[model samples]
Target: MYIPSPFRDDDLENMRATIRCARLANLITATSGGPLATPLPLLLDESEGEHGTLYGHLAKRNPQWRIATIGDAMAIFTGPEAYVTPSWYSSKRQAEHVVPTWNYIAVHAHGPIEFFDDPDRLLEIVTRLTNIHETSRATPWAVSDAPVDFIAAQLREIVGVRIPITRVESKRKMSQNRPMPDRIGVATGLAASKLARDQEVAPLILVQD
Candidate 1:
């Protein structure tokens, strides 16, 4: 996360928002063998620890959980992202220097990685995670919907993860480095893009002022 001063997002609330909106995250760990990474749907517990805690699980057979991490693990969460073309810059017409870049939001959370197999804690984490994602559905599902034996059998196949965040680096690169005219040009160009992510990024670029 090489964030320039202009693009750094230091606001705690904003950082939390980005994490919450990110449904999936890449969990990376350094091991004696090599680096291992897994993509998982994670839940952030902002109430825990100074920064926060991340909760997720991996398949019981996944080797990543077996290896001991040398240091803190990193959870990478990415928000809306779009490619920005130099043609969108007003400087293009003035023969001024301009190059293509990307506009996006990302958060990197680093913390000590803890793996657990306690069924109670696993059930709590899984239940909360399921509720969070299913709340928007007309027929929201719950862990209690399944029989106790069935749920216990399913839980046996997974292991729980708890990462107490020690550091968080957030970046929101939404054309904040560009001049007003260039930003407007970018917004206009992105708004017209056929990609939904580009359209979503267009407003963020325009709202930065």
Candidate 2:
């Protein structure tokens, strides 16, 4: 990610929070054949390694897991994002110098990729992942909810992934480069947008008083 100093998010805790909030991540790997990417719901274990560890799984038949990856892989987590129009910039009329841009948050985690087929480890990862997403539900579900034979049969169709994070790059382009008035204008414009995603991203770029 090409993040300017003003848009760089170096706070480790904030970066981790963004990762946790992102329900899905894009896993990218460089292979001898070419580059392959898969979207997956990944779990971050912050206590595991220097940076952290990522856990997820792929379908057993997915060729991505069979390909060889060089060195490390990347997991991309994306947060709220919105389009900023030139009309929202105070500088637009100053000298016709303003152009459109985007505001968003993203985190990239780099780590050594490891794939496993151990049923026990697979069961553990699946259980933890299920719990993480289901905890907020009124009727929470668990992997153990199913019969043991059924669960084992399901696990046979998937392959587990573990990546020990070596580095994390976070970027938050939230109009920090704009002046106060311009930022405020952007927030106002976005807040009025009909799109729910725009409304969600608007407050993220609000200028501090």
Candidate 3:
């Protein structure tokens, strides 16, 4: 990820928050055939490594897991994002030099990826993933709710994924490069937007203030 100095975010805790809040991620690998990518939900274990570890699963038949990767895999987690029009910038009226841009938060985790077929590990991963997403519901479902045999059978059709993160890159482009007046304009404009994502991004734009 090419991040300008003003947009660069090196805070580890902030990166972790972004990862946890992201509903899904894009896992990319460079294979001998070509580049392959899969969109999946991955959980981060911050206590596991110097950086962190990622856990997820892929369908057994997904060729991405079977193919060998050329280098370390990358997991991309994107948080709230919104389109910013120049009309929202005060500079547009003063200098008429402002152009449209985007405001977003993204974290890229790179590490060696290992694929395993161990049933025990797969069960643990699935259980934790399920709980993370379901615990907020009134009737939270759990892996134990299903029959052992049924769960075991389902696990056979999937492959477990583990990535010991070697590095992380985070970027938060919330108009930090713009002046205060322009940023305030952007925040108010986004807060007025009907899009949920835009509304979510509105407060982030003001965090620097």
**TM-score per candidate, chains pooled:** 0.97, 0.96, 0.98
Whole-model lDDT per candidate? 0.93, 0.91, 0.95
205 Cα displacement, candidate 3 (Å): 0.7
Instruction: Single out the weakest 10-residue window by summed lDDT for candidate 2.
Output: 200-209
The lDDT-based order of candidates, best leading, equals 3, 1, 2
Q: Write the per-residue lDDT of candidate 3 for residues 1-209, one digit (tens) a residue.
A: 99989999999999999999999999999999999999999999989999889999999999999999999999999999999999988878868777899999999999999999999999999999999999999999999999999999999999999999999999999999898889999999999999998999999998963
- Candidate 3 least-lDDT 10 residues: 90-99
lDDT of 1: 0.93
What local lDDT does model 1 show for residue 84? 96
Give per-residue CA lDDT, model 1, range 1-209, as digits (tens): 79899989888888889999998999999999889999999999999988889999999999999998989999999999999999999889998688899999999999999999999999999999999999999999999999999999989999999999999999999999988999999999999999988998988997774
Per-prediction tally of clashes = 0, 0, 0
**Top candidate by lDDT:** 3
Task: Order the numbered candidates by TM-score, best leading.
Answer: 3, 1, 2
Best by TM-score: 3
Off by over 4 Å in 2: 207-209
lDDT of 2 by residue, 1-209 (tens): 89889988888888889889999999999998889999999998988987779999999999988999987899999999999998998878787988899889999999889999999999999999999999999999988889999999999999999999889999999999889889989999999999999999888777432
Q: Please report the TM-score between candidate 1 and the true structure.
A: 0.97
Better of 2 and 3 by lDDT: 3
